[model samples]
Target: MKPYLMIALCCGLYAGLVAAVEPITVAWRDKAPYHYRENGIEQGFLLRRAKHIFALAEVPAVFVERPSKRIWRDFERGKSSYCSIGWYRLAERERIAQFSVPFHVDPPHMLLVSPGARATVQAHKGVATLLQDGRISVGVVDGVSYGPALDRLIAGSANQVERVTVAPASLMQMVAANRMDYMFADEADWEYLRRHEEGLDAIVEQRFADMPAGLERYIVCSKDVPAQVMTRINRAIGALSDAAPGD
Candidate 1:
């Protein structure tokens, strides 16, 4: 090959090598509008913002997806380099992961009950009161953190609540099937399910006013991520011009 052609080929190879550098494996759960399928593409407030932050960090990335509990399990077991999008800054999570500053404060997880069960939930004063009353079984996803206060409430009433490891879709299916009395869901997840789930129309909504706020989400990564990279990610997050609104 000519000298110029040789130089061009070398540059192309270098570019490819850089682009192919091991990406931070981002673990995503199928929960919207934080992370979910839309028109067969991944799109959500958190996912979109995460993409921009990752790009600004100038790192290659790949996504691995699973149900909520498994997402955390896989991330812990090395199935993914880290996880991006929609992690509430719970104490347990902070212990194991490096989390970016708040990307957004999401709607507090609310009481989602079936239409017929509406009377049952409403009969109680609030979530804590209802759980303490124990007239009904509350459904919750296994690994999800319902903020600090709600976690305490659920922990206090573990017998009254059922914890299952399933995808958001299946969780709604359970409620629709009346297999579980109710589950704690955010507004975004409920809205997404409303469009796709057949029986989600029967799901009723209520507030947890007693639950404390600061249900903010952050980009959480495994311990192995380089300090510099995390710093860059944090910086990128801070500089984002279009942050998703907080609750």
Candidate 2:
């Protein structure tokens, strides 16, 4: 065979191999300091880490913004090659999807108490006592988890719970407006809201002595995701250092 013809054939084969690799769809929601769009570009610590992990694994990925409910729905529908970052590993979720090794550790959660409910909230000694009190109402975001321990506590609590589908910042605003007595907020989330959102001055940040330890977040994907792909992702996560700030 001619040398020029051999080179052309090799080039064509390489192109075919590259074209055969399908990019995974990485779904994310709008959560500042974690995952959000700024200036029409994706930005956040978790998002950056995810991108790095995928790159290190040599996996092709395409990020798309979607609502949290929709992300979970895609998994429920058995969507292939779909993944989402920074989700808790829960039993029900495990039944529906696969999870990677934990990639991020959040700080302990704090309570955001409404100004009007300050006196009432202060009366309780800890999270347990506070949740058991039916007098104080709590607002929770729908389809969100506060880790297994806290989630169980919230479920078993006698407190009046109001579930809403809103961003954490908007939930803080609801607290300021006295929509509910208090709600759980991630330490990092509170920091971001405190610095950026207005009308939060009246909102009181309270810490309980019995609050559960911070939960680890993982890259959750549809069950159809290849085990080999997950293995690569997990290996990449293991190789990365946890020294990144705000993680």
Candidate 3:
């Protein structure tokens, strides 16, 4: 090859390498305290932490706001680069997306029952029982993953339960009106709801079981995302643990 041709080839290779570096597009679910938008700016605890990770990973970042289910679907389909900041590990999800070690820990999700149906909320009974009685309905986002037990319950008798898949605020609205009998949501989410939404006073919160393993939130990546990227994210989150607030 000619000397000029050799230089040209080297430059092309360098350009290709740079082009291969991926910028992560994070999905933001408008869950208050964890993630929320204000004054046209996306901001929240997990989201801020995710921004820190992106900086450490040396990647550019963009936030995509969507319903929880849509976000997961987009991430799985590679329509987006990154999933939301927190989600539980799921075996089936592992087949589609890679997840980082706990970037942010979330409190266990508790079962919320309408005050009128408090008698129907059993600590150990199958959720199906309440649904079958026609006195209760469960609220969940259409595609949001809730571990095996809830999955089985929904699959086996989901039709019996009045199901509504909408934004976080909507679920609380359903609960307040007694239209939704049961809702499995993180404790913090409900706390946020109580403060913002009126009539949430009629709802009762109860802890049923430790959330299924897959439902525990973590930072999930697209299947094609490199493992090195995940490692960088883990390190960044670790650093955050030691980092002072707002650092």
Best by lDDT: 2
Summarize candidate 2's per-residue lDDT along 150-193 as a digit string, tens digits. 98999999999999988889989999999999999998788877
Task: Candidate 3: list runs displaced more than 4 Å.
Answer: 20-22, 67-70, 79-84, 120-137, 153-160, 208-215, 242-247
Query: What is the Å distance of residue 66 in model 3 from its true position?
Result: 4.0
The C-alpha TM-scores of every prediction are 0.76, 0.88, 0.77
lDDT of 3: 0.71
Candidates in order have lDDT scores of: 0.75, 0.90, 0.71
RMSD of each: 5.4, 3.6, 3.8
Q: Give the distance in Å from residue 77's predicted Cα in candidate 1 to where it truly belongs.
A: 4.6
Q: Rank by lDDT, descending?
A: 2, 1, 3
Screening candidate 1 with a backbone cut-off below 3 angstroms (N, C-alpha, C), the clashing residue pairs are none
Compare candidates 1 and 2 on TM-score and give the better one. 2
TM-score sort, best first: 2, 3, 1
Worst 10 residues of 2 by lDDT: 238-247
Q: Write the per-residue lDDT of candidate 1 for residues 134-225, one digit (tens) a residue.
A: 66887888866777887887889833677788876788888877787788887777777788678677777888677556487888888878
Task: Write one digit per residue (lDDT tens) for candidate 3, span 70-186.
Answer: 877786677645656777777787887788877655555677877766876673364445445544567777766666666776666533455565776787778778876778777
